[model samples]
Target: MTITPETLIAAAQSSKAWPFQEAQRLAKRMPKGKPGGVLFETGYGPSGLPHIGTFQEVLRTTLVRRAYEALTGGAPTRLVAFSDDMDGLRKVPDNVPNRDMLAQHLGKPLSRIPDPFEKFESFAAHNNAMLRDFLDRFGFEYEFVSSSECYNGGKFDTALKGVLSNFQAILDIMLPTLGEERRQTYSPVMPVSPTTGAVLQVPIEVVDAEAGLIRFTDEDGAIVEQSALGGMAKCQWKVDWAMRWVALGVDYEMYGKDLTDSGIQSGKIARVLGGHKPEGLIYELFLDGEGEKISKSKGNGLSIEDWLQYGSEESLGYYIFANPRSAKQLHGGVIPKAVDDYWQFRAALPGQELDKQLGNPVWHLLRANESHAGANAPGSGDTLPVPFSLLLNLVGVLGVGATREAVWSYLGNYVTNADPAAHPALDALVDKALAYNRDFVAPTLAKRAPSGGEVGALQALDAALADADPAISAEDLQTIVYEIGKQPEFGFDNLRNWFKALYETLLGSEQGPRMGSFIALYGIAPTRALIAEALAKA
Candidate 1:
């Protein structure tokens, strides 16, 4: 079927996906008959290596951009990935090397500081390169913008002058948000020192809006008058953000929940500069495995490298795409479920109606156009015949020392067409499962002795499996296991406990694959042996 722009736009208008919803919000703010269409911007601070959160912001913004394109019937759009490299480095980051050397450059712009690793022209340059590489590896289409270039090359001259003119207005909007002590020294403009090359945080003594200049006292008690434009000065954090939005005419941007107040204050500053503030989503921050807020300085959160090491790229995107509002514990443990969910969604997409398909996260992640449809979706060739969670459990049962060949041998029995060479995705999943089993599952595995009643149930299960045909279907086998559990003679008041006992005793885990599937995959004789081994423990 031919999918026209009207179908896509109708789907986008009615779709409840967060990206489409954000795009709908953005449509209201779009300027009438703007040249070069709409602009979407995402900010990055190049004080350190870009983390997954940075990638997430760009990915989320790109999602919205794609939805906007669909909403506007393929109107032109540009995504600017802005890096704030001109901001001062207040202190040394705990993650990087050469702490003593970096300490000397404190209060200097990140773009001006020496690279700790000595790879690029400046500290921020090294980090900026890394950020670009990170985004490039993910295939994100964006134009990279350097804050230092904008400030130093006179690109922000008019915006800087606007800030100078509205300095008082910005101060009024900002001062009420600060505490009593902070309000005393607060200034919208931060002049870069000519002698020291540090971004001065001192209060501005005078602002010449006409000449685009500011006067301030340096740290050495020297009173200085400096050009507010052409790299001589930069705005404070909130003001800088607002000035950027105004200068770029950004249509949309998104930030972490922690910065919601800052976004609001910056929006006010943007309006003060005679430019409209961009509409955006305020998403919750990612947390560490311990449920503490992820800090780049502390190196506590999962990096993009870490997530990709254990899961596919699509799985990582799926994890980020699920819920922008809810905080998530990002770690190694979440990868398996993410992989399974990604495939599950992909498999379901072909059957869903147009509206539901548009709402599906996989639709946005995989489909290029409405006509790209689920049957021929990009990356659909990589779908695994088996779920990632089942693969993980297979590795769990086979021990951490399980080999790829051994996994394929069992998989071949369950899925006759399952060939490691043909199923590259399955092959990769097997490797990830083995690695996860080794790192996370192996250490925690401990077989506990079964209760007296559970022993009887195990015996009954083993006997039942021994008498049944070895070629029974997985679903039929499941019925048998369910029936055994439901037997009043087994004394299981709750059916869940019966499965829990099986997992604890047989798999040494609190959770496991379906017993029917496990038995069918492991073979009836091997399962009987496993049951005998569990009974012998008594």
Candidate 2:
């Protein structure tokens, strides 16, 4: 499909990808001809190390920027991953090394606290370096901004003045959300103590809008006068959000759904600060399997390192692309399916309509780099005929930590023409599958005990294999399994259950690639022997 300008424009206009619609809304809401292209912001909190959930937002924001550029005749777009490091260290992250040290720094800004690992200038710097390292590794296009720098560098001096001038109005906007006690003392600006260098949450004794200064009681109850400018003081979160939007002239920004109310308040405060709010995109947060929000404190869901260990960077990108507005489970268990779906999209990309291709998440996943994180690297051979889940199980057939060449040799048993060396992309899957098996599958296999029905089903399958053609293809073998499940005694409701039966008793996993594909690759005789052995104990 040759994607023409007209077709691209129409597709961009109707694109269901959140970024495309966001670009259109931003283009209308924020007129062009500004000093820079459309500016977008992805907020980060440095209280904890970055994770997969945080990484997805940056990648997703980049997609929007790309879409915006295409829609506006290559309009410029800048994605700023702004970290709110100036916010106080409310609590120590459960994962970091130095808990006792961090406990001593509570109420101190993240940028001011000591690095737990003693590597960077501060805890925030360490986290920031970690974020940049992986982002650069993935070749993501973004600029990093620290809230501490913006505050102390006097970069937001003008924004500070504007907020202070409208202090009463912002107070009126915020007071309704606070308790009566907080309503009386809470100010838009959160004063930083010059004496102890902590963010003072105490009552403000004075505010001088003309001078951009606030005097408040410090943590020890001593008077501390601080300038709101030059990073001596930072505005409270919602107010700080509004100030940044105006200071940077952010055209677009996205937030988690939990921030909906705070976002609206930021918009109101933006108006009070004599500026308009950025066009906003609210995404549902990634959740653990238990349907609870994934956070550093909770220690649930896969970390960015964990996800990348068992899957490709593009696989995680595709996971982010799938129904982003809807909350999704981001656990180790979801990795293989994401990898398989990426292949499905790539396999289907060819012969697809231009608009249809545009709508596919695989399309975006492929172009992980500039001009693309294309699912198939240029000249990289096609995806393996087998799915990733299936590949993992087949790789597992070779036992733990089997080298790629060994797995390729195993594939040669059933496929006379099998050559993984020709397919770098598919071969990489073999490596990841080995990692997935060693880490996620091997341990679970120790406790897999088939139920009575599943045992009978396996026994039945073994008996059917006894009479099956020794030279049957994977596709034909798949049909035999389907027929076995359809028999009255098995009474399997669907192929899904039938497949699950095989996975539980055979692979010792909840999901596996199609049995036919495995059968075709494993060869008829070896597969039957494996099944017979598994059913022996039944």
Indicate which candidate wins on TM-score.
1
What's the C-alpha lDDT at position 454 in model 1? Answer: 94
Report residue 362 deviation for candidate 1 (angstroms).
Answer: 0.7
Worst 10 residues of 1 by lDDT: 367-376
Q: In terms of lDDT, which candidate is strongest?
A: 1
The residue-by-residue lDDT of candidate 2 on 363-453, one tens digit each, is 6655535845344333244355567877788877767857888888767755446776566666777888899988878777732555666
Write candidate 1's Cα lDDT for 442-468 as tens digits: 999998888878988999898899899
Candidate 1: residue 143 Cα off by (Å):
0.6
